[model samples]
Target: MLSSYLTLAAILFCIGLYGTLAKRNAIIVLLSLELMLNAVNLNLIAFSKYGAIPSLTGQLFSIFTITVAAAEAAIAVAILIALFRARGTVLVDAFNRMRR
Candidate 1:
């Protein structure tokens, strides 16, 4: 059961990695980042449940990670919105040159 959870997380992380690297849209990149973070959370929960010295530490860490990821997403969305207003595009490549 733990192995299955790990395998699923690995697959999710890999897909997220590919999306982050290969996608051009800023929104898609942000979603991909969220996916990767979720994979890490899965691992944390799995270990917390299955480890020899099973405890709540991993779950607590996962909660903290989720909180941080939420903040990151909010800030990132605000920045993306501002950038879109200024540049009229959300392509990752378009954000390379931020100066006029």
Candidate 2:
């Protein structure tokens, strides 16, 4: 069951990665980011539940990751909104001017 959970997490992570890479919309990318974060949380929770309980490190890491993901989502959404306002479009290709 633990291995299954990890496998599922890996599949979800890959799907999210593909979505983030293949989509042109920033909102979709944000959603994909959330999905990837969820996959990590799943892995953390699984390991915490099945591998170790006395230390609680996995759980702590999960909580920390959750906190960071929330903050990242807020910042990313705000930046996406700003980009939309400035460009009037959320297409990834259109944001190429951001490239170094």
Output the number of the lDDT-best candidate: 1
Error of 2 at 68 (Å): 0.4
Pairs with backbone N, CA or C atoms under 3 Å apart (clashes), candidate 1:
none
Cα lDDT computed for each candidate against the true fold: 0.97, 0.91
* lDDT for model 1: 0.97
Tell me the tens digit of each residue's lDDT in model 2 across 24-67: 88889889989999999999989988874535788899999999
Residue 17: error of model 1 in Å? 0.3
Question: Clash number for every model?
Answer: 0, 0
> Runs in model 1 with CA error above 4 Å?
98-100
Q: Which ranges of candidate 2 are over 4 A from the true structure?
A: 52-54
lDDT of 1 by residue, 57-100 (tens): 99999999999999999999999999999999999899878475
Error of model 1, residue 97, in angstroms = 1.0
